[model samples]
Target chain A: MTDQNGPQLTRIQQRNRERILEGALTAFSANGFRGATIDQIAEEAGLSKPNVLYYFGSKDEIHKTLLTALLDLWLAPMLSLDPDGEPLDEVLRYVSTKLDMSRDFPRESRLFAYEVLQGAPHLSEILGGRLRDLVDETVAVLTGWIDEGRLAKVDPHHLIFSIWALTQHYADFEVQVRAVLGPGHDPYAEAQVFLENLFRRMLAT
Target chain B: MTDQNGPQLTRIQQRNRERILEGALTAFSANGFRGATIDQIAEEAGLSKPNVLYYFGSKDEIHKTLLTALLDLWLAPMLSLDPDGEPLDEVLRYVSTKLDMSRDFPRESRLFAYEVLQGAPHLSEILGGRLRDLVDETVAVLTGWIDEGRLAKVDPHHLIFSIWALTQHYADFEVQVRAVLGPGHDPYAEAQVFLENLFRRMLAT
Candidate 1:
């Protein structure tokens, strides 16, 4: 999708952009940004190198585009935490939404993980600025709930960290998880049940 | 350290080997296996390229050596989860030890994270075999605790996953954590307090 000030991309152009971003997600997630080449991304996208370049100026641009979009998706669950909603219920809803995103968007989750793992060079500002502001708001919300005895008292920042860690593990560490658990188990479904119980037991007064 | 069956190397040989592995950890942790080269690892280790190869046959050998050591350290926490100890205390100790590892051995943590995130190509056998077996034993120990009314009723596997996800997050996502928290916070110390409370609350019968 074009920015409001930009001219509209043609339908085909939009599709190609989406395809490039999708393939770039695969490439970048599997290989760190430095390791992934433009040729590899184009190959993964089923497009020629020049074709990929024609759509995005360079690998960095493609990466920036993906990271920008991913940051928004990454923030959605935290952004949706309703201060007006029941405290425990709202937190659970946030956890559930994040877990669903991990299941539905494992590539995106790994992309975020990879970026952050490489020192978040592309994301440091957003991590400190946009993401921080939202977490600050969330911290306030959780603190208020805890102070009111509407939820069990816990450090708000660490609580947020815990949620991120628990949900993203399924996506970022799927191999170890699968290897450890062996075959024939539904990880996401089981994780949902386990996490819900764990959170409820942790947060319930 | 030399293999028990092998003749011991000189002290200088052992130190150089440790240097190479340490440097390899930094390189591999920052840039996944595909991205890191032996030259880069040599540079990180402060040794010449030929000097580096003199100790290890190749980059793959160096990476393998680092991971083999990492997996042992990784398993140390879980392996020490004593079956005969107080169930709650044993679980809490496991959490504390793991969190300590995340604090003290962050690079090792990220090195393992990178390997797993990249599908554990070199580690599939060990993951599916040794690590899985260790987790199986851990699951049995946890099940025994819960069944004996010594611990809360919870899925042993997911419980172990939670311990992993929660503790490892502090290390694997250190950049994001620091960015969001800003300056002046001793993250590991704060994490320890929060996680101790979290597990305590969640595990109390």
Candidate 2:
């Protein structure tokens, strides 16, 4: 069995893998890891259960792949936080970009939110290693901005947490947001203006 | 089978009921609703499974009771948003109370967070009805403050959302918070000062 599965994938393998992942994200995002089933993923992907298992050894493997892919997409904005750029403008841009992602790609946002809510059991390694490293670098960059008088001195970790909380609120709490904001109100538009003004005022020297 | 349940017991019934709920909260918070079981709750409460079921008809009933109780406790501070009080102060006090709850009643907070993270399937009725109504009233009060020139004109709903996001981050993301903040940092004290400055700056007339 091990020897049979040793080699790299062909184009058919790549296509089937993509199909399975697309379906898995939807199921996992909506039902959570424990609540989701491989059969459901198979049906959603329009593939047989064995076929699904053929691409990935188990549900755990598929989940890890999805999470790793999401981590990259989710971390893109933070990775773009330029240490040399104008501080306040850079922060505002980050906030706006994050809010945009929340609006445009709510499923991916919710998937990340779900994993983190579950104490990130599957992604603990990623959180402990990759996420921790990224955050440390960002905090160091933020501390430099503060020391240079380019930004107000605040706890860099908490500042990042606040930014995350505010931006992800629109996506993670969409039901509440939509209900309270009413059907007609555009939350993203208001969120953009509110966040820009908020970060600008909060970080003003 | 229906008659087997019989009438409720005297003092013992109430006492055991409370014990069951307390134990369930710990289990449910730690393992989530799906991951938890009556056996674990029974073991935690020092009662057998049948004895636990005697008080609550099913695991779902126990979970519902805990959720209902938590909703009341969770909404207490928001309920105290006196329309006649100073707007920013009322809001600040509300924020502080929530932060305190996040610290003191973290398990309860996590239980609620877990529910919402799972799409709030079990509690959506209460969330959509009672919780929604309470937020509406709270938003009206904030809007009144804005209209009266008592606070900076801002989107009241988003304002409330921001307060919730900022405060709950301490508890809901406790692992991440500690990991990033380091081993010795006191998140609550720093959060209090940071939040005070944040709201003060945002709401300053």
Candidate 3:
């Protein structure tokens, strides 16, 4: 995971790297990057501190590695927003895909949340560069749809933000959600229904 | 602010407490509770550590105090959703008011985000008890509106959660929003219009 074009690692090396990242995700999500330690991450990963360091040069490298990987996963949903598809269906798919990520990759969601909450110290450059470009492209698609009267005219950027905020809230504030929801309620299932109706109603031309 | 029923504090005492809380807000927002320390809070507060201790018995007390205060502020928008008002208008007003809070109280938003992100160790009880009860009451009102055909039928709880998720994103994710929007864009002002239109269209019977 360190070098994009680096030599392929052995099977054992691959498994160990995955384990370390999974452990780092848990530790960093529970404790912010500043509060997390390499020893703690090593313990979480079930590798010795020295062994963990053997894969990554420092804690910063581990964090950056985790974030770099997460950014790609995070970008997948937006990247898949098909510009040539039926506009409403395309957006509904994007919303559902993002919600699925929140449910399936909750740790990744919280880890990213923590990073952004602390001013995105590691993510600022990417947020301005790659992320900005991606949103711009998606916005253009939405604008095209609006121009054709295929979708309602709303601020497309804020529309994307709304999808993100609603979907991620279920994961990021899972405890509060579960507590308020009490027992027996499937929050995500209900949210899926709610969000579909919401975007559908709001986006109908 | 510590003891609500206690004797009133002198003006100087009140100012000192406010200063400490302001500083703690910055520290805790930047660094989660575990990452923060008395010395850091004191340094941020511009008080001696002993002085900080003198005002608040422990770091936990200060954090709890800040949260307690923030909770009241957070609840105000929802609390003010008058049952007698036009249902759609009430909801739109609620969204606009919440967006306003995000603009005026970004630090408080981030502080609360940090606490909740870490599972709200200091706030679990309130989440299940008071917060749950408040939401139940609000949801009841929303359900009543839907039954009366005053508002569009939707999952009232998820509706509230959507409002929260959408509004809070601007504040909690302010840096990312700012970066993506680039310069010269007023995110909150733009958000206010977008949200008002969103809830209005979604909730109209």
* DockQ scores of the candidates: 0.85, 0.50, 0.82
Question: What tens digits encode model 2's per-residue C-alpha lDDT throughout B137-192?
Answer: 99899989999899887778788889888888788777777766667889998999
Winner on lDDT between 1 and 3 is 3
Residue pairs with backbone overlap in model 1: none
Model 3 has an lDDT value of 0.91
Report every candidate's CA lDDT.
Answer: 0.89, 0.84, 0.91
TM-score, cand. 3: 0.96
Model 3: CA > 4 A from native: A1-3, B1-3, B7-12
Structural similarity of chain A in candidate 1, as TM-score: 0.95
Model 2, position B197: C-alpha lDDT score:
79
TM-score for chain B considered on its own, for each of the candidates? 0.94, 0.93, 0.94
For model 1, how does the per-residue alpha-carbon lDDT over B128-189 read when each residue is reduced to its tens digit?
99989999999999998898898888889999999999999999999999999999999999
Candidate 1 regions off by >4 Å?
A: A1-4, B1-4
Output the worst ten-in-a-row residue range by lDDT, candidate 2 chain A.
Answer: A1-10
TM-score of each: 0.96, 0.91, 0.96
- Cα interface RMSD of each candidate: 0.9, 1.9, 0.8
Candidate 2 residues A1-205, lDDT tens each?
2113547878898788888999999888776777789999999899999999998999999998898877778888999998889988888889999999999988788787767766888877777688888999999999999999888878788889899989987887777666566668898998998888777778888
Query: DockQ winner among the candidates?
Result: 1
Between candidates 1 and 2, name the one with more favorable lDDT.
1
User: Which residue runs of candidate 2 sit more than 4 Å off their true CA positions?
Assistant: A1-7, B1-9
